[model samples]
Target: MQFHHHGYVSGDPRVRPAAGVGINRPAELPDEVDVLIIGTGPAGMLTAAQLSQFPNVTTRIVERRAGRLAIGQADGIQARSVETFQAFGFAERIIAEAYAITEMAFWKPDAADPSRIIRTARTQDDPAGISEFPHLIVNQARVLDYFAEYMANSPTRMSPDYGFEFRSLSVSDEGEYPVTVTLLQTSGPNEGQERVVHAKYVVGADGARSKVRESIGCTLAGDQANHAWGVMDALAVTDFPDIRTKCAIQSGTGGSILLIPREGGHLFRMYVDLGEVDPNDKGAVRNTTIEEIIGKANEILHPYTLDVRNIAWHSVYEVGHRLTDRFDDVLPDERGTRTPRVFIAGDACHTHSAKAGQGMNVSMQDGFNLAWKLGHVLEGRSPESLLSTYSAERQVVAKNLIDFDKEWSTLMAKKPEEFENPSELEDFYVSTAEFPAGFMTQYAPSMLVAAADHQELATGFTVGKRFKSAPVVRVGDTNPVHLGHHATADGRWRIYVFADTALPGATSSTEEFAEWLASSPQSPLAATPSGADPDAWFDVKVVYQQGHPSIDFGAVPGVFKPQVGPFKLADYEKVYATDPAADIFELRGLDRGGVLVVVRPDQYVANVLPLTATAELGAFFAPLLPERKAAAVLSAATEP
Candidate 1:
């Protein structure tokens, strides 16, 4: 939201003045580029959005579709995705238009009648209150449109190249652009024509039947779960009281339905259990008709009746759980010496039942995680070793998602009598709510993610997991805000220094630490290119335990008020005071003495340390950040 640093912005601030590659950008695909991403799905669009932040890197994304996705199959927006939308500067807008899932009701056959259905239990969607963001239900296409708008207004002005279908790609160890790709024109005058492009790295977000995955010899290696479900987005009138509410209904003899209320109030999606499919009847379930699905739904409801008005969309899908061995082209034998040039993401890496509502949420995270690493490596901000961590971290997360979805999908497919306890479905849903809400993903220890040896320093800010936001008051404006909200997807590491019980500018631990960070050559701030913004490479902010009234804004350290933009205006938004009503220190379990947290560009807590541990702080960022010598080479290579 901060603007006008360069000069007065009389026009809309959201539309940034395009620069570099965005200035009168080429109309056709380049012969060579920094990164080439395939597909315009959830993962692909997010990848483009993140890479758009780096104007210096030439990134191109192509989709087989003639234009943008009109209607996407996925609609479930988990709480974690809403947090990501906030980072991209569109959460409020999307939430305003999205359906907020507040509670979920479970239904079973009536014990007295056995022929009718009755509500068994009802639970809050976010019972644990894991995130301040809500569980949303919005169209997948709308999410893509938001990202597209953000990209258009970004410095890079990125947009997907439509009608270009990916055919194949090959990797070489010898050239700057090691990955050579073949694309087929699916529309326009060049239809059926083929062309070639080369890239330093390539990402395949091309979905389950990804051509990029096939060219890389990666296989989706799991079997069908022998269950089929018919899903439809419909406008219907029904006596079922929970039609507007999310419901899990299991009939005594018919089947089950996982009903999800959609955004426009009157519309909702239903995943009608089409019963188990025989192993030999692979594609048979797809033939299940909409009328048949409605009949099954009516049977499940028993005494209730549904008058279908309109059908927005419908599909029949067999539940299958599959995952690739690795997300990149690097073989197991080539792990040490080789760097991955061709990579796959989203459905290319993992596939599971859509019933869990995880397909889009998880895929978007795949793009978010990989884009930062690719940006770092391409821009020479980090070594090639950083690229290896993407597959290692995300592959494990995908596996965990598959496991959870498998259990949830199986439970939904069961008959009411099959469960030892009639409330088994509701119990399981309540118990593992966090996982489905997208807060349970914890990346294991790696070069990027540090071990939890110092976790107690900020117990709430768990390492290897997403940084949870807490309320704090900005010192300069005295406005209450979330600390994590200040951290955006701008490809800069965050250094959040939680000050000890001391006033700003005082001769205390915070003062000494701030001075050293602003002056020390070993500090991560030194990595910022000369004449660039002081916080170009690292965003340094300080939060004090003291209330806003006790702090003098002018006395805050220079590190928290670094001069930015052409005017060299002091950025006063970095200094914050704990909210009196909800102190972040107590809420997040931060050590009263002081603690320094290192958060990656993706908003995951990377490391935690004592504020006075200057050497430890320097050591942590030393390897991740580029030295002046390496940055100079990057400058020369990137010069226009």
Candidate 2:
């Protein structure tokens, strides 16, 4: 949203001026690239969108499909994904068009009748208020379209190459572009023809039956749950009272239905339980018809009826949970000795039942996590070792997701009478609400994630979790805003300094820290390339524990007023004060002595430290960022 920094633009600011490979980009696929992505699913599209910001890094995506996906099976958008969309600058636009889930209604068989079902419990969505953004219901295709638009408008002008299917690939131990890929044309005049391309790194965002994953010797290792469910999106007249609301209904017998209201008001989706599938049955459950699904739904509703007008989409799938042994081509024995050249993400690495509505949301997070590391390593901002954290961090999260979905899916398939407690399902739903909302992920301590030794500095902003935003007043314009909303998906580290109650010019902790950060070679700010924007590699912002009127703007430290752009204009938006309406200091439990919070490019809190812990802060970033002397050597080596 910050435009006209380099120059004026009367047209859309989203459509950035193309540079590097984006300038008059070749219509034909290039022979070599920095990063090559396969498939245009949620993981692939988001990967391309994130890498598009780095024009200098040549990134290409290829999809086997002839064109964009018309209808996507996934529809649920969690709060965490909405927060990510805000970073990419499209959350508001998508939310305006998508349906916002507010409450969930649970229905159970009536005791008196035993045939008819009655609403037992109604619980609020996100009862814990984990995120400011709401859980949404939007088509997966539309989400892909938004990322596609972002990619098309990015500085790289990156977009997927349709009709290219991955045939095979091999990685060389020594080479500039280590991964040599063989792509076959799936359509057009060049159908059946194969072409060769090479890349420094490759990402497999292809679905469960990914050839890339197979080529890397990784296999999904899990079995089916022997449960089958029939899902359909329809337009119908339903006598069921909670049809418009998200509902979980368990019948007197063994039937059940999960009713979810879709976007565009009238359309809704129903996942009707189709009973258990026998282990010997070889996909016989898939042949279940729309009429049979509707019949099963009617049985779950008892006296209520569904007069179907039209069926938008319908499919039958057996619930299965599977995850790959590893996400990358690096074997266990060669982990520390070798860097990964090929990586898998999304369904390629982990898969589970779609009923939990996590297939696409978790996949997007996978891309967001991997793409930043790719951008950093390829752009020489970070070392190759940074690539190792992607698999280490996301694998744990995927395992946790599969475990939770297994329990949730089982409860949905179970009969009402089978449970010891009648309200077990609803109670479980409320207690574990944060997981489905996509706030349960907490990356364990590693090289990228610091230990929670200083978590008390900002209790609300938990270490290793997403940086929850709170209201702050922008001192420059006296406008109230969520502090976290300013951070974007441009792949830059964020350092937030919460100043103690001290005057701007006074010799306090904040002033001394800022001066050190502005001058010291040990500071991460010193790593910024010469003649570039001062805040290019890192975005440093300061928030004070005081009102806007009480602050002195001119007396603020030079570090906060970074000189950016060609003309070196002082960016004044970096300084902020706590909003009196909602005090961030109190909301996030900031220490009165001041605290320094370091957030990764993916928006997770990387480290939290005290104001005077300058050496500790520098040590945290030292291993991640390249040293000045080493960077100079790399620059010379890369020169033509």
Task: Note the Cα lDDT for every prediction shown.
Answer: 0.90, 0.91
Write candidate 2's Cα lDDT for 340-403 as tens digits: 9999999999989988999999999999999999999988899999999889899999999999
lDDT of 1 at 129: 86
Task: Please provide, for model 1 over 277-304, each residue's C-alpha lDDT reduced to its tens digit, 9 standing for 90 to 100.
Answer: 8889959889999999999989988889
Error of 1 at 260 (Å): 0.4
Clashing pairs in 2: none
**What would the TM-score be for candidate 1 when compared with the true structure?**
0.98
RMSD values for the candidates in order, in angstroms, are 3.1, 3.2
Give candidate 1 regions above 4 Å deviation: 628-640
**Model 1 Cα displacement at 413 (Å)?**
0.6
